[model samples]
Target: MNERRTAVPPLIVTQDNSFFFEGAAAGRLLIQRCADCGTLRHPPGPTCPQCRSFEWDTVESSRRGTLHSWTISHHPQDPAFEYPLAVGLLDLEEGTRLVADIAGVPHDELHIGMPLEVGFAEHAHGAVLPQLRAPGASRTEEGES
Candidate 1:
């Protein structure tokens, strides 16, 4: 995978959330899918909120999403993050919305309904992340209508 320059720290993954990180390492964006109701959920968990079932699994995302909302931080919260950091929400095609750092687009230009794609940024400690980017940044739409 190509190196995506980023300064944020690697995300911590535990027994409950290893699937997301593992998928990131393998260069795929993964989200939680309800084994019973077939609904997708982000920030993966043990129970399906839709079906109230304890059964769940991972689904590799379409890696395509639309920018829903955002707030750029002019104040530096962490030196690891660049000034004007864009922390935003994306509504994925699979019906799940996730919060992640939006990259490859000027912070000031971000707005609602902007097309986006995923890029994997490898952390210094070796964990990978699913960072957001513009749709035209060499990403192909696969199996997504």
Candidate 2:
């Protein structure tokens, strides 16, 4: 029997941000750091905004962060996500903020400053990305939704 598969759009990986995806594929969360100014940035860029330096390096995150903000979405559903999806803005221990899907904790329990950690999950198209979870949550499980 022929099976139909839902395909998530492929990520547009560019030279500036390839490291981020590569890291996630390797079960790591890598952030770009400006070699000259020691500033950290997310959504990896070609040059550091703080110092406009082309020289940069990667830092492995502690994978721990506080929930700085969050929102739940319910409309315009996509095949890659579940309904009532919870997404969060996390303030990482290393001083950089990253946004990711929140899981393992109910929507009501999520609060500002609650501790969470980064975990990798395979999404549509088998792309690995970070998912935020409550501390001590299992990482071996596949992403929900």
Candidate 3:
């Protein structure tokens, strides 16, 4: 049987949120945090959602979290979604929740409150997308070099 190997996607350079693209490309998961209230925020906004303060900082999470919620998507929303994808929300250890694609596992095996880790999906367009995986899960043989 052949295994599926994942690749790194190209990056899209933009002015404000370019760091997100770069971080995904490098396999690092990054999110914005409010320096004032120490609240974690996703989508990289300029202001803190909790304190509504402009003081913010870039933070890298451990990429480990629990599955908050999820859904299996068989329909392709875009041409890039060629395979069956699991879209999920991860509740990070830092009290932040992030929306990402869950990979490296079958959709039936996914469960709420399951431990998850972060990974990067390399797209052909050079833009990397963040993905979630079961704890200690590895790619298939096709994914290996």
Candidate number of the best lDDT: 2
After the best TM-score superposition of candidate 3, give how far the Cα of residue 22 lies from its true spot, in angstroms.
1.6
What does candidate 2's lDDT look like per residue over 68-109, in tens digits? 999999976776788799999999999999998998799999
Write the candidate numbers in order of decreasing TM-score.
Answer: 2, 1, 3
TM-score of 1: 0.81
Q: Using lDDT as the measure, what is the rank order of every candidate, best first?
A: 2, 1, 3
> In candidate 3, residue 135 scores what lDDT?
74
Q: Indicate whether candidate 1 or candidate 2 has the larger TM-score.
A: 2
> Model 1 segments beyond 4 Å from truth?
1-10, 138-145
Model 2 spans with C-alpha error above 4 angstroms: 1-8, 139-145
TM-score of each: 0.81, 0.89, 0.77
Candidate 2: C-alpha lDDT:
0.88
Q: Residue 3 of candidate 3: its Cα lDDT?
A: 28
Q: What is the C-alpha local distance difference test score of each model?
A: 0.77, 0.88, 0.75
